[model samples]
Target: MQKSVRLKSFELVAGDIRDVDVELLHALSISVRWPHRPKDWELFRRAGHGIVAVDGIGRVFGSAMWFPQGDNFATVGLVITTPRAQAQGGGRWLMDQILEQCGNRNLALNATHAAYPLYVSLGFTSEAIVYMRQGEVQQTLPALPTLGGELNELPSDRLTEITALDERAVGTNRARLLALLAKDASIATLSRGGEVVGYSMRREFGRGFVIGPIVAQNAWDAVHLTAVHLKNLEGRFTRVDTRERDGVFAEFLQRSGLGVAETVTTMSKGRRFLNREDKNPWVYGLAGHALN
Candidate 1:
């Protein structure tokens, strides 16, 4: 594989799995239809870090892209295997290598029903419940926190600070992941103070803007930031996803006016990142659809 990565078929790779080739990934995305394409897959790897699993022929049969939540904890999932390459441990091999790669770090991942068993076999347990709420942009940012707000275009420096704050809100640092999302022309943010206290980045997914990563200092902050962000984009349809909010920001959106929508499980395996000394929970928003 290494020798072939040096070859023409697979040698066209660049950056990391996060941002390798949107076209290639877009091709792969067709394979990931059901749950929708989680923005972080494109964004996380775009942040300029991830593990690539290339076949000797240079085809990316399977890969797991991960971005660190901070210096210590890391959320590493987004395991993918080509449709032709599914089963037969192709996906598991990619995950195994990622688990080994992120051994000591507080690793997190979002698992699908098909792969949940693989994750459990690897020592992961369920973490949170993800709720998918679909509706028009409510056109309201709920009253909460500082209500501090600022609009930001990615690649702009403010996102850097917001990325840090987002980690604090979510307990995992993923500067690399946020960086990835910034590449898309549509990525943007809203902050309170000089610092980026909250943010929302979305893409023209399907019928509307699929709200990928929404972060803030708290529940209200996150929801507020999301509302303000969405209201700005008129005429476009929208869907905002929320993580299971049982922690400090328990059922935040439940009050934010988002209905139950649909439910998805945030599955995990291996060592968990709880209220440990190394990991801190400042999670104002979710890292991505899966892990983080």
Candidate 2:
């Protein structure tokens, strides 16, 4: 539990997610027009440390979260402030609480163009561009690729492999979060000679299913992995948030019926930590803008 700090008429409480009212948090999200649903908020709470600002009347006005990735890295996200709370120091106070909790670890986040200045004021610099794409799946999509590796359902026994590959690709140890996601998400893996080479996971999120965290050796392999995940979702709404560098994969998604919806700039503070070794240019897609 975090000590509560009083600021003007508001109290900044280190979130005890179990006790923090999800309904209140959901209401805050809706007030800001954030896409996260109540279930998504639960997932974030379960996976990270958070802080919420409550007014004297006990209404949630602002919220922020930071997911620890290994010992030296963390990702901050879900920072929101009610319209009435904006420009009143609530957002900055929430950010300060999460940063203080994160200590000296490197921090990263996806910031909207509107919020980019605030993050820059906190010493963060743009690292990459992330685009959110979504649409109803087309009924007549191109056939899945037959080349590259064979795609199959990710086996429970491959948890170790999944974590290792994810760390190498994403530059962070998120085994605990991955474990939780695996339980509720449909995951597919591409294997060559019985060794897993790439993977993708699709799960119900927001308005529909979101396919992401796609990790692969190259653009082609990523397409293959993503195609396998999309095959089962034909005619259903699907969303994917991908990096701008993965333009080919993004094009493929656009061709398959999804359209670019919005863009966010990925920013980092302190030293950049994502490993992009040539052996495996892995992070073709992110788990989600928030999670990344």
Candidate 3:
């Protein structure tokens, strides 16, 4: 399809799809391959969802979904547009559909350097800055805090506690989106006695891994969980995208031998979701973009 010089009219079809090939999606030039492979979309679709865009011929051009989070918050993510379908109202169409469906939640996205301009133009504001780190694994990392929190792998029956804790740490929780979170492999938790405190999750990002929703007592709590999780994968060079408030996590990353690969501005549109009272923190690692 030829790019439209100007979109005279735009249309969007609102719905959900669980199976999106992140590699194929990137191959279409809808996204950049920071880590390609659709690991999280399955879970996002299983939860609650929002919008998808299709051309007049009824083929998917690009897509976006507004995922539900606890505390009545929602996040917009899994956004993509095909190269053959670019500039012909695909992006704008998906945007309109998502904004309308998002319905006043504090929407969030871990944006790429290329897409920040479009996000700003669409009325999303950066709540925090994120710096991505790439390349080889460092030989040493900051020690995990003992912090008196008992650590345990999440059990299948107790996932609700983990999800509930996620809402407490972050404004929203994407527990409903990915079925894998409920699975034994991708989940871990930290607590005191039986009381749930913090949790961590990992999903394959292309060939490597990405850590998210590493919720904890605070930034320190989350970082502790993050390090413990990363330690399990010490030899792998994983990509971590975290929303920064202060320089705490960034410093921790630097000490671990990681550098700032890229900086992203997390933007939101519509009403600000007010689940968490405090604004700033050291840094926030996403559980999943679809979940916020």
Q: What is the alpha-carbon lDDT of model 3 when measured against the actual structure?
A: 0.60
| Candidate 2: regions farther than 4 A off | 1-17, 143-145
> What local distance difference test score does each model get?
0.56, 0.81, 0.60
Question: Tens digit of lDDT per residue, candidate 3, span 236-258?
Answer: 77666666534666677666665
Give the C-alpha lDDT of model 2: 0.81
CA deviation > 4 Å runs, candidate 1: 1-22, 34-42, 48-60, 135-155, 160-164, 179-208, 244-262, 267-271, 274-284
What is residue 3's positional error in candidate 1, in angstroms? Answer: 11
Q: Which residue pairs collide in model 2, if any?
A: none
Per-residue lDDT value at 271 in model 2? 85
How does model 3 score by TM-score?
A: 0.75
Mark the 10 consecutive residues where model 2 has the least summed lDDT: 9-18
lDDT of 1 by residue, 214-286 (tens): 6554555555555555656654556656664454233434434455566656654445554323233234334
TM-score of each: 0.66, 0.92, 0.75
Q: Quote the lDDT for 174 in model 1.
A: 61
- Ranking according to TM-score, highest score first: 2, 3, 1
